[model samples]
Target: MNNRWLLPEYIEDVLPEAAWQVEDVRAKLLSLFKSYGYELVIPPHVEYIESLTGIEGDDLNLKTFKLVDQITGRQLGLRADMTPQVARIDAHLLNRMDVTRLCYAGHVVHTLPAGHFSTREPLQVGAEIYGSKNLTADIEIIELMSSALKVAGISEMNVDIGHVGIFRTICELAKASPQIVDQLFTALQTKDLPSIAELTINWEESLKVAVLALPSLFGEAESVLATARLKLPTVPAIQDALETIERVCVHLATIGVRCSVELGELRTGFYHNGLVFTAFAKGWSNPVARGGRYDNIGQQFGRARAATGFSIDLRDILRGLSTPSGKMSILAPDSQEPELRELIAKLRESGEIVRVDISGGSSDELAWDRKIVKSVNGWEVVSK
Candidate 1:
């Protein structure tokens, strides 16, 4: 027979030590989010296909696992991303006109692994601010992202910042066709200079120069911003985008967080409209967290709200840290004596891990490192 106990590809169980570490990180991050005034919200694991993928576009649609609802005979989808579901809640459920901040933690299933060594199921933890168009809101979200990672013991990280509006403006000015725009977007994402040159070879001279300059317009935020101002067109939109990046960098500097500007980093899907960011820790090829402004996403849900947020995979964070040590537990004899039971309860109440020896087994077979024995005075804990 085939290995009946084997798990599917890219799916594995989180054993005891790692599970405890994940729980500890999750609790700490959620508490940090709460301290910042973001209310917690739990969106369901499955949602109507339209509700889940409607706002995010084809990327999310392709990643989502779909099924038919037996009761309603309508299509349903396991959420590949929770941001859109949270957006739906903000738009339809809350129906609040004022600013709203929401945070969530849960597992999201992907049809395929994101990379060669990635998991299909990730514990996604994130926070989003809706209805605030102010740059301060974005700053606050970034600060929260930094703090959350630091709380998870990842102190040294780099935040790469970019603005989609920069590329959007360049595309509009060039009047590039949909086919050419898509090709150029792919080339830019990989920083493929030759493809960028070939794609823009026939475009207007000024626009061609700006497009070619994009792939090189990354590095220390201040220097990159200055070079972009000089090399890129002086259109209002492009100028505004650069200014926003500069201001965000200045704020980050005050907090001692390092950042770089990448004008060609437009990998986020079509939903993002403005400033975008991704945080990376050393030794990980993929980003630890990513988010951006998607002002028009809520419009698909019949409400237009200015939004920005970031999400990190708790499992990803766990992989970067050392394995957690086993927790020591106290063993209490399974007995009918009221005093023994009271003592066990008191030990547990004092934050001790007490396990009752229900099978009357040796302490070596059990996980407990200590045992309770009746001393002359009363029941007392002793080393096994």
Candidate 2:
């Protein structure tokens, strides 16, 4: 009897078109990152647990896969998020006098996801901006993020912007107890207004209602603002955050792009101390991408720098892409070896994936296709 548990709940197997879509989206995203002056960086998958400590907050404590290095006897963990690793690079390796823009494309490991179908090992494509505290820098990150999503084949995506400080500021005014603060954060995440109202009775009637109402105050940009204006107190910090969100939408609109603004959104990681935003695809329940301003993470790594950036889960991208097929061509071997190499190099250089036929001349095309050596209907044969 063989006892083998082959499949895990949080990991996935992407096949064919979906797989192709993942790679294609990655390439396009990397290209966009480069065009924006973001230098690509690939961090090692395994690192000393100390390296990733205090990075992703509670998520890190739960999702990391741990192992012991036999030679060094140090505890190692698979990275749960790339942003912290990027932060380490900015603070240590790339400690330059000038601002550094770093981008990463890689897999992040996590345990237990909100959705049953979520991947345990998620592929991410994202960028991090260092050495800038200017609001314009935040806006540029948002702008570039929107453009990158469009390039990834998300035609009608919506970006919802929020400020972490707004909710925290409001909580302070409410004088929320620890229980109430946790409950408020939970209610905001779940969008449960009644529960929030239940916990808010100790505050002023109008304030309680306003606090409770925030959970439901989300919609189209204008509608969200209209609803929020009626529900929220006239606090300067909250108002400023709202104004920042408004400006972001206005900036996107002038570029002929539309984004929804929401003030109640919360980030899984508290890294974002300022503005936070999420990108959603039509018909998808959860966000395909999320990022925000973390002015403090750099400080934690020995540099008191302000930073903001965003990342997309490539697995979600594969789920959202409406592309019909993920195909690549491989030219069959030529009688002249140099010709075959030339064709392969030329195709790859032009950004088209191709494989040179290395097997003997009479290799079966059907068998090769079955092995995924070339995408179905994406192979060609040439003879010299």
Candidate 3:
């Protein structure tokens, strides 16, 4: 016989203990977002393929699971990321000109795991700020992300910050072709200096030196920024990128959040045009949170709004935290008596977990610490 009950590789259920933790943490995060004036949005699990993957580039497209809708025949895709959907809502649905704050929590399905030990279905929790291009927006996003992790019981985390525009500006100056840029981007991700040199062999000396220096510009925020300023050309765009990183890092430092700068950290993908960051907890091997500025993302939705945000996978955060203790429940006998029913209802109303024994079976399998028994005092709870 076949083991038909097995789940797919990289896909598994959130059992009771984990599910409770996920819900508990999700509630706290949503509450936190709300406190920050971020209105919550619940986007659909699926949408037109264009709306989901149009601006995020080939990486997101590869992760999305696509299928033709039965009714309209238009292609539909399981959302791999909700940022694009939130952008659409802000652009088309809300259409507000002022700075809009939106937060979302939902399951995003990916065709493949993002990493070796990752899940295909991740409960993504995120907050976005639109219509603000100020560096303050980036600062607020980073601060909010730091606060979010702390609220989730992850107090010690390193925020690895980078600016994609730094590399993009250098590439533009070198007049690198898209293919060459793609090759260099892959190499830089791995800090492969040899491959970077090979790719930029034909480039001018100055441009090649700047490109090669990117991989080495990784360390403490202040020193890295200082080194970057000294090594990189004083082009206006590159300087602006460096300044942004400095300003954000300084603010994070003031708030007691530790951060590092990685000039070659462009893992956020093509759409993220500016400041990008990843939050790594002490014990976790993978980033627990990621977000950055993707101003052009709204352009695809017919409105170009300056946007910044970050998302945390609840499962990832849960992995680092100890499992939440199971809630104690009270066992009650299944009965039709009005008084018994009233007592159970009253107990439930008072924040008690009441599990009625409808099957009249053994209580050994039940996770109940107390029981309701008919005694001298109408109906009373007693230790089981």
Candidate 4:
């Protein structure tokens, strides 16, 4: 019977109660975006492999699941992320010169699960702003993302900001070979200070000290920036990088949003040209949401718009959350009575869930809250 009982690992069904949670959050979040003038778009699930693997999509390459097309006999890949797809929409599809605010909510399948998020499939809900390089645009996207988590019942959320520009610029000034750059990138990612020291042994004194200090340049915004300004070389690129991070922090504070700076975070070095960040709630070790500025992501599509955005896995935010309560329902007898049918229709129109009981005895399929009963007056609702 082809192992009907077995299913793939990391993929499972959402029962009724859990489905209700996902649906409720989806409705609330999409409505929130619409209120903010961010139009929602749903790109195709699969596309020509090249369309998704543009310069911006390099980070997603290893995560994408590719397959052969049956009709065209060409290669196709399931989208691992939706940012590039939205970039294409802004660049090629809309072709608007003015700013474009786009938001999306959909399932993105990955070849492997990411840290602590064991599911290979994630429900990514995000918002992006195009054609605006001002820090305001970045703040707006971050605000929207922070608000999303709050609305999802997360509390005490702090957004930790970073900049790929900080490290990228430092590396450029060090003039390290590509091979050395690769090694330093890995060493920094893992915070292997010994390896980082070893990699920077040949660089000039100031440059070497700055490269080694990069890993420790993380904490509350002012404190980290203070340390960076004193300890790191005062090169133009490093100065500009620090300035941008401070500007983002200032903007976030004006909006009453809590944020900190972490200079080592280069989540989008492959695509991001400026700032990057991750969002965390009080209790979680891993970020509940993450995003950054990847300006010129649409360059591949010929527009080259400046852009920034953020996204969160809807499923992960509610991972520890219990399934929502079942639908509140009223039980009624199955009958040909016109009056009873009319009553049911009225209840349904009033947004009440009325289920007709087909079996004479009780059925355990539905968790009905009330039952309709005949009375001297009109029908009465009795507690179940």
Put down candidate 1 lDDT per residue, 1-384, tens digits, no spaces.
979999889998998888989998899999999999999999999999998888643778888999999999999999999999999999999989999999999999999987656899999999999999999999999999999999988999999999988997898999998788878888898888899989988888989999889989989987999899999999999999999999999999999999999998887666788999989899777788888898967887899889999998889878878986878899888897999999988999999999888776655653677889999999999997
Local lDDT at 182 for model 4? 68
TM of each candidate vs. truth: 0.95, 0.82, 0.96, 0.93
Q: Lowest-scoring 10 consecutive residues by lDDT in candidate 2?
A: 366-375
Model 1 segments more than 4 A misplaced: 359-361, 365-367
> TM-score: which is higher, 2 or 4?
4
Task: List residue ranges in candidate 4 displaced over 4 A.
Answer: 56-58, 177-179, 254-256
lDDT of each: 0.89, 0.75, 0.91, 0.84
Query: Candidate 3: lDDT over CA atoms?
Result: 0.91
lDDT of 2 by residue, 1-384 (tens): 755746777776777767767787789889888999999999999898877767534556566778899889999888888888999899888887677899999988876674546678889789889888788888888888888878777777777887877777777887877667767776787788777878776887877766666656677887898778777877898788778888888887888666877777885465667888888877667787789988868666787677889887777766765656435454455445565456566767987655445666555442223122223544344332
Decreasing lDDT order of the candidates: 3, 1, 4, 2
Collision pairs in model 2: 10-120
Candidate 3 lDDT tens digits, 310-350: 99988978887899778889999989899999999999999
Clashes of each: 0, 1, 0, 0
- Candidate with best lDDT: 3
| TM-score: model 2 vs. ground truth | 0.82
The local lDDT score (0 to 100) that residue 130 gets in candidate 2 is: 88
lDDT of 4 by residue, 1-384 (tens): 689978677876777788789878988999999999999999999998887786642467888899999999999999988998999999999999999999999999988887664578888999999999888898788888878887776866788888887777778988888778767776777888999889888888988888888889888899999999998888887888789889888987987778888887765446777888888886565678889899888988888999999898888777756666788899998877777888889999999999888888466688898988878877767999
Supply candidate 3's per-residue lDDT for 382.
97
**Candidate that would win on TM-score:** 3
